[model samples]
Target chain A: MTNSTSIPIKLQDRSATEEFVQKFDTFLFDCDGVLWLGSHLLPLVVETLEYLKSLGKQLLFVTNNSTKSRSQYVKKFAGFGIEVTEDQIFTSGYASALYVRDFLKLTPGQDRVWIFGENGIKEELNIMGFDTSGGNDPRLDEPFDVATSPFLKDGLDDQVKCVIAGLDTKINYHRLAITLQYLRKPEVHFVATNIDSTFPQKGLILPGAGSAINSLSYASDRTPEACGKPNLNMLNAIVKAKGLDRSKCCMVGDRLNTDIKFGETGGLGGTLLVLTGIETEERALDNTHGNPSPKYYTSKLGNLYEFTH
Target chain B: MTNSTSIPIKLQDRSATEEFVQKFDTFLFDCDGVLWLGSHLLPLVVETLEYLKSLGKQLLFVTNNSTKSRSQYVKKFAGFGIEVTEDQIFTSGYASALYVRDFLKLTPGQDRVWIFGENGIKEELNIMGFDTSGGNDPRLDEPFDVATSPFLKDGLDDQVKCVIAGLDTKINYHRLAITLQYLRKPEVHFVATNIDSTFPQKGLILPGAGSAINSLSYASDRTPEACGKPNLNMLNAIVKAKGLDRSKCCMVGDRLNTDIKFGETGGLGGTLLVLTGIETEERALDNTHGNPSPKYYTSKLGNLYEFTH
Candidate 1:
């Protein structure tokens, strides 16, 4: 397994970082207030993306927020100079869609879906070839054939197959009531985006999909089948997409919740936490969260090239 | 007090019916399938009412199904007999609304409501001058506001006053999740229609609101205040409305679960069970569910009139 603390010093400038990139065929990035908030991009964000690719790195940006469409994030990323197509990005939403589809053996494009989150998650379900025509309209919350997404309904008698809790407006009482109902059904599957309570936003703290994950797990008496980061599914997907070994890949993230934690738990080459986001080593020490600490931590990213030196 | 055992003979035919009408000052009826099925009326139920009224007696139907509107039931019963108004009817739905509104000091028109049942119940809330504006459409099962209702939108973390469980079409896992979440808070009230496990349909039985009631109550560790018949509030409502002496009123019904049982606990007159719907004398004899048995039991409706005679 890779440790963030062991990131070697041979990495400097675009060339040196490029050498590390060539050494490892795969790369992963974190989303949410990390890339952009709503429609605004962070400073030097575009240069960071351009610098990585010029050095020959295989990049994959992962987000736990399933509320927006991947294209929406793609559009958001593009605004920050990280040019990418839908295929290059992986979201917890997409993983959740696939998980439900395979678990139920639902014929692709056959079952109806009731969505409660963003369009990106919905589009990903579409891309995976699942049917999502419900649009979460209340008139259709009944015990239908199969509903992929567990959108918020108007009342207490709608049927839902799975509760794909990504990011809804707020994890309020009504949502909890429905999720708890489905969870009690021993046969139903409960999948959450990521267990990240807070994520970085323009360098400020914000709540993440973890809040929903925590509530559902506790109320339903079922541990969620997580699909986003620090999990085998996403790592396996990245490895398959790039045709690289999971052991040799590096998952770069500025926050310990995703980037560094993924590197340590997912067995990537190593983790690199940029002070630009999430937690600091001092904070990590104080909290002692995540049994193990990040392998390496840097104050800020004036230049990724500087790390290669 | 009126008995469920018989048709007042005086009410049965002119002068005879008048003699019968002089016997009792108040009446009570159960909701669920007894009142209407979704929206259909039962057979020959109207003539009996006119017969009883012709003899001149007060009537109050007590129900465990707290999902219907008194006005709605009034409108429904109108289809059965002549000239019935909302005030002439009684429902647990109205009782619960009043209890929640008065006991909780809930400003109906001002608070956001996270509703879980039917339109009849919702209509009653509106009539009570509550903020007929809904909180989260319980149909989506996902709560817009987790703790407080969006109906009032107090914008406080703990502002949700109560969760009303009526007949909701979108009651799913999400709604359960939300209900459990808010119920954990001491301030939020968990109110339910009735603890009826199965609702009568034509002849077969299907699960009723009690299922949802059980789900949330068990998971959240909060015993909701039940408002339907057989509950104390229902009995109190009858006493308040009729000015009837509790010792004199006799609860007559075909079901032992709600009507007959209430006599053992809730302070109504003793009970008489008729063999038309829920209970049979054999089952009652085989195992009188609780320790005490109902005051009387007979082969069917109008048998009570014979006993009274």
Candidate 2:
């Protein structure tokens, strides 16, 4: 939890990242359920960021919640007492768009799509230069070529090119039903922004975007293409922006599944599972069988204060 | 699917009990995941039974894959299926002599115990029938006041009740670890008749008697009690003598979960799933939904009939 960028290292408590200054340059952080849950940031996170910044460390606010656009996150940071540019924020929704652009080539004119994700994910798709404008409400629009889950109904006939999934309102079952219908078609591809089921909170675990994905996968019986953490889509994007070697980047977060699993699942480096956030000591003890046991399981960011002071 | 007993009309094809009746009249069904996966039955099972019994309701069989007692299910099955003898083969593994006589106040005598589960799951402080012939296998033959998880690895401090949950390999994990050590306690009871997982197909689900009751529920969580299924300890010894109102008796099954669910998961029905041998169709459909729906959804004996007239 040491803010490696700003906090001066004392003769005592320096993190491995701090000790080996050049080994890791970029720090990727999970936003929701880590930095903040719902609408507020956790206590001490701001200090942690400030300390890291004081050290001149590079930081990226990465998120899997596709509900908001980059502008929204910038606004969120202001509310959290932190000033950040849209360029400083990254989201799985952004990654999903990049993935579609690079891998999913278009043939100039293609079938139209009806999207149900928030404006962020939708805008990302639109940015990719795909012909996707068909109005937000699915019922009023012309029949779309594809519809994503987290919104659409299930069991519809083939016409949908893909079924995309992202965070959605709990009241979005009718939309899910529609998505299920479109996804039932053999031609539709199923995509999920990420798959971290339990989002960490203050000493408790809450459902995350993955809960929405779980429903989509169950109803459609299709495995989703993950575009977020631990997936190449996001990693490639970071590489394009920073032009840094993979070894020079590290991920830190509060939960084990998303933050820690991202390191292993994506073949990245050193993961830190901070106890101050989501996972409990007992849960950490249970996952001992896997390799890379959370590079470091620190109780809290305050613990690093000892190493620094 | 069909109720062979009294009002022999088929309501619907949902339970696999008709198939169990076709095979074993005196059946012991395990509940959970068997009779109703999540919450509904395997499809088209009712007619299968009514169809079979229309020919003639034969010997009826139904058992559970649970550690609870039969009388427990007798109370559960007031409406879900056909009405029958309290002794009509409904069963579980928690039917120790004391659980039967002393706990139920049905018998007058001392209690002896044989365990395959943990001590907490199978114990009775009684003077009449305590199995004193102890030697080794702290689970089977040893002098321990009480049994505990293997993690204890020492001696038991609690008064001996009974040894149970036989030989669970999963006990090697933390769950079984605690239960196995519990067996070493002195002055306890030891008893077991059967151990079956809540699920039998895949996923290494928690089991019933044998080692599962002790290791899974007791060691891992639920805290199990062991009793022989189809034993005099439960309905096993009593069902045959109690002329089953087979016409009023209906059995349900999803084979692995639903059939097992109803049969054993503390449901109120005489149920079991069969591959034509144990489960119903709807349960299979739900379990395998969005993927391959169940074959022989008919749940009729035809599933097994490679060659039928």
RMSD of each: 10.7, 14.7
Question: What's model 2's lDDT at B49?
Answer: 35
Docking class of 2: incorrect
Residues forming the 10-long window of minimal summed lDDT in candidate 2 chain A: A3-12
lDDT of 2 at A162: 57
Per-residue lDDT of A74 in model 2: 88
Instruction: Give per-residue CA lDDT, model 1, range A217-252, as digits (tens).
Output: 554546877887766776776676767777666666
TM-score for each of the candidates: 0.51, 0.50
Looking at candidate 2 chain B, the ten consecutive residues that score lowest on lDDT are B3-12
In model 1, what is the error at residue A298, expressed in angstroms?
A: 12
Residue-level lDDT of model 1, residues B1-309, one tens digit each, is 333333222122344433433545555555444434444554434544555566565656776665557766665666655467676666767877777777767886567555666665666777877653232354354443333434224433444577777545455544544555566567777788666655554443334556556555554556778887667776776677667777655566656667766754665554555455655557555443543455555554343243334
lDDT of 2 by residue, A1-309 (tens): 322122222222476535643456677777765667666566677777776777777878778778787787888889989888888888888877666656654322364444545577777676555555322565523322223322223533333365567654321334444555555566766677777654543323334456546545554556788988767678778778877555656676666656766765555555566665656666655645342346555555534334454
How accurate locally, in lDDT, is each candidate? 0.58, 0.48
Residue B18 displacement (Å), model 1: 22
Interface root mean square deviation of every model, in Å? 9.9, 15.5
